[model samples]
Target: MTALDTSKVSIKTSLAACFGRNLYEQPGAHEFLQELSQSAQEVNIQQGGYIFKEGDPSDYVFIAISGAIMLERSSPKGARHVFAFLFTGNLLGLSEFTVYSFSAVALTGATVVKINKRLIQNIFERHPKIAKSFHDFTTHVLHYVLDQMYILGQKTAPQRLAHFLLDMDTRLGRSSGQFYLPMNRIDIADYLGMSLETTSRSFSNLKKRKLIEIESSHKIIINDRAAILEFIDE
Candidate 1:
């Protein structure tokens, strides 16, 4: 973990970004943000550094201000599952229990703002609109997880890879149909529940079919978006 010089990064601004523009524009949003900023602390994490481990005290929630964070869990036998990769504006560390259910690590050098969970809950209690917006945000995350569960359970290797690419494009692509995969093939395999070789083979297969172009190990260009969609649908 590295200490961040947060003089220029506004905690309130980061919070507003994570919570979304709609919530930031809500009534009493200013007061809510002010309270949060007063207690928020920004931390910079080096790539692969742990943000919080599974079973750690869930005393704080975090907002990614920059870079990427990987949320994952490991079983007692050492089997691992990658839950999700969080980018800028993503909220994390909220749990239903006293301890974190999964671990968060910096997928890249990352900056995150941390706020005391108890303070946030108290503020939410006083701000019904903010609470509703937060509920909606969390529900949306839940839906994404459920969708991934379905894909992993039902999709074939190629289908799963296609879905993953499309999903990544939706989250990280530019207008040019290009995106950088911050994670490597092994990470993709772990997230998709496929072997690493299968994941790499799927990428090659897609490139061979001209549905996508792999510029490098980390860069992808969607050559035929429509065809890729059709492939997934088939």
Candidate 2:
């Protein structure tokens, strides 16, 4: 709930980055970004802190500026289902309903820009192009959810793990195929809908097959992406 004096410049930079160069380079995009920056309030969240809980009023939208964010939901019986791990430049807290359908939590010490949904709506009304861009962004998010559904509904345990690794590689990996995992095995298990033991076994299996190298619990290097892809195909 504590707000930081996040500079307008920083907000503009993060917004532009999240919107992508293609959109930012569009006519009037600079002014539109500035308006968004001016309306945004930045907040720093400690590790494991809740940004917004499920059922809270969907009054604001958040854009990640740094670190990782976990979007999840809990069953009445207290089981948790992780939806996604959002990194820098990802958007969250967007809901069509009056209340949030899921909770957003900081996976690490994170910074995020919070903008009132009403204010954004007003801005979007004025900037049709920006609104179109945002629509496209939401479409991408929908596709991501669909992909996760496919992974959970159809893939085997090892195939699910493979898809998860490839996804993290796409999101957080370097050209050298090394990436640092922000979430632990338990988080991975929850996100992939597998037991922690099964998730761990899948990682071990990949390591045994020389498809990936485990530098540490958090650091991973894909030794052979082709083989990993082949395994997933099999």
Candidate 3:
């Protein structure tokens, strides 16, 4: 496998620049970021590599610096279920216990900064705003997970596909109305709780309806956002 910027350096070198150049809009976050990022170390994962497996001790949480990371779980029968694909600025390893409940794998070769979990408390003590940021982040993650559960239980195959497309559009596509889908059809089928053939058929139906267009099976273009929204089961 090809290397992807693997390094173990102090935050003062690279991440420090990321913090300063981002011009974080949050007031009073400068000191908090400094305090939290001090002991951070950067690690790179090549595509298809495992960052951490299920039952691994969650000593450190990760912040994606580049590429994509996929959170997944395997059933007793060894079927893989993808929960989420994390991108730059996304946090990983948020759990109620000391061990990670799911596995994190590199989808497209990712660079992530590993910060010890101990820093969470320090940040909360030093900067309440950053604590609020953590709260909001946790809430959004929970809501999205719950939304996926609901989709699995209540929505039809086509509806689920439409909802997933809208979600990608809102979070990743934004101004462009197009974005790269790192997960393949099988992964997406697992994520949406459907068969691979069902997932493919749904995509074909959407294209037939002129609601979306697929390019090279990875880059997607949403042609009719309003029409797609109508297909979402709510």
Candidate 4:
């Protein structure tokens, strides 16, 4: 097989290893996802694969099993704007309020459980808590998206990258003042809406400041996380 095919197979294996089954399928989390799991199915995507294109029909709401997905929009001019990174435990294509406004592409190989909207609707009708949980989750997502907008509109390139790193570190449940980055520089740039060169320079600047060290292509070791968080808090 070709190198690209080998890489896809490796990613698929890693994703399967990380998540043997959907976490939400368990008896918890208000049963919204669990009930839907009865009829749900999982699909795997190769790296750089498009899960759904823009203007596609919104049917199944996907729950990620492993890796990450990037939701982006492309203009006729060929410029691309990444909207957000959907990580494990995040849902994709759940636009109950209106039609989906973005397209999702796999950033890495990923596994997702596809849930029927009709099934989810029935569950919501029966259990009010499920609806409340979904509302809360979506609200949290909106707040993060708005925060990204603020970062994009107001923050400098360095600040934007710093804030993004800090936020991801916090979410990963790493120590309160410790962190790392799992994505590559280009992915980070796309997620932050900056050039790859800018992103690399920011990392160099951070390292020179003794704030962090690039542990590997897929990892960063945070040093003075306190100062980083302090700067981000401002």
Candidate 5:
């Protein structure tokens, strides 16, 4: 894939056209992004390749330009915990405060844009709206973390699985009846705090109940929205 020059007229025009007021017309958004594009380097990561490890210096924030990125943490007992499965337009490394708390690894062949901390800080200082946008993004992330904690702590396997799918549909905007599962079953299990077999069985059970339909392509179809909605209560 060709690298994007953030300053060029073509990229700017396309971004302006695609985003309209949300991007191009926003206060300092285009300028900050243009500044970012000047230094943003696109890097490719193969599936399973690490973008960064836990405890590493938080010098850079990465934007997922393409494919999915997995944020993972390992427990003392060596259990893998998936913090998130980030897709296109998702930002990583913003919540770490200083050092990376979780490792960012590629769930698939991915492309990322690396932005240094200095650049971000400078832009944020100049653009109050941009800073507020970042603040809002982090706040949403915190809420998501709390929601996951509740699911893992109190929800049963089926409930957790149901909640996970619903949340994925909302976050990924995959409400077109089909949602793709890029991460493997093991990763889903880890994310949901269940065993791999349990996670797999949950999917099978959902299919049997006519709540969802799973395809070999890793695509899932929500057959009955009401049934899926009431699953957590049951």
Candidate 6:
């Protein structure tokens, strides 16, 4: 790992900085991230680079600073499935069960803070509160995963897309109402377990229903939030 320009730490750092105060308030979280700040190194990977491969020994945990990484699993037949999109402040490689159940690959130029696993364990041991915070974090992640499962397993294509858009809007909102998206249809398709064509068609349907408007390929305007939510609920 190389030294990063401290002045230009990415959104991951911003997220950490914004939440760091609250994180410190959490049980043992301050000492953990502080120690982690000392030991962790900032590293960058190019788009499409593998951060860690599936089945690799879990040696380090990653905290995304910028860009996005996909956690994916592949079948024996080589068919690939995406599991999650890890954004800034997301913890990587913290599982105590399997070494790594999926591969983490950069979706774009990515920066992450890499912390040694041993150091993480030591921090957790020294502060049981740190362990509890981690536990709560993982539990929240699990709930999000289950929600993703519900979207994939039951919803129609358009509904799934609506749900995805709403989720992105909610998560990335600037003033809790407006948000801009960096990901395109293909990324959404891969995340939603659908084909790109289907994803595109879903957007078309949403536009036709006046639920959202595609200002451009990379831009969207959600017209009726309530209607979109109702559609998703159905």
Report the C-alpha lDDT of model 2 over 109-223, residue by residue, as the tens digit.
9999888998778867877877888888888888988988987998899889988898889888744689999999999999999999999999998888888889998899986
TM-score head-to-head 5 vs 6, winner: 5
- Model 6, 1-234: lDDT tens per residue? 764334454633543443342554676665555665567788899989999999998888888887778888889998777777777777788777557888999977888878788887887688776566667777778899899899899999999989888886766663253456666667788788899999999989998998887877767777678999999988
- Could you give candidate 5's per-residue lDDT for residues 174-223 as a string of tens digits? 56666787888999988898899999999888888788888773778776
Highest-scoring model, TM-score: 1
True-vs-predicted CA distance for residue 109, candidate 6, Å: 1.6
Count of clashes, each model:
0, 0, 0, 0, 0, 0
TM-score of each: 0.92, 0.91, 0.84, 0.78, 0.87, 0.85
The runs of at least 3 residues in candidate 1 whose Cα sits more than 4 Å from the true structure, single-residue gaps closed, are 1-14
Q: Where does model 4 exceed 4 Å of error?
A: 1-34, 97-99, 172-182
lDDT by residue (tens digit), candidate 1, 1-234: 333333455544556666666876788787776765577777889999999999999999998888888989998899899889988778999877999999998989998888889988987888888888888888888899898888888889999999989888877884368999999999899899989999999999988988888899899999678888899878
Model number with the top lDDT: 1
Candidate 2: where is the Cα deviation over 4 Å?
Answer: 1-13
RMSD of 4: 6.9
Residue 137's lDDT within candidate 5 is: 69
The window of 10 residues in a row where model 4 has the poorest summed lDDT is: 1-10
RMSD to the true structure for each prediction, in A, is 2.4, 2.3, 4.8, 6.9, 3.4, 3.0
- For 1-234, candidate 4 gives per-residue lDDT tens digits of 111121244334432332233323423433543443356666888888878878877886776667678888877897777777766666778776445567888877887766677777776677665555666667877898898899898888878888877777765434554444435677778778889999999888877877766666556666667798776667
For candidate 2, give the lDDT of residue 180: 94
- Superior candidate under lDDT, 1 versus 4: 1
Q: Rank the candidates by TM-score, best first.
A: 1, 2, 5, 6, 3, 4
lDDT digits (tens) for residues 26-109 of candidate 3: 676666556554566678889999889899998887777778788899999999888898776677886768889899999898
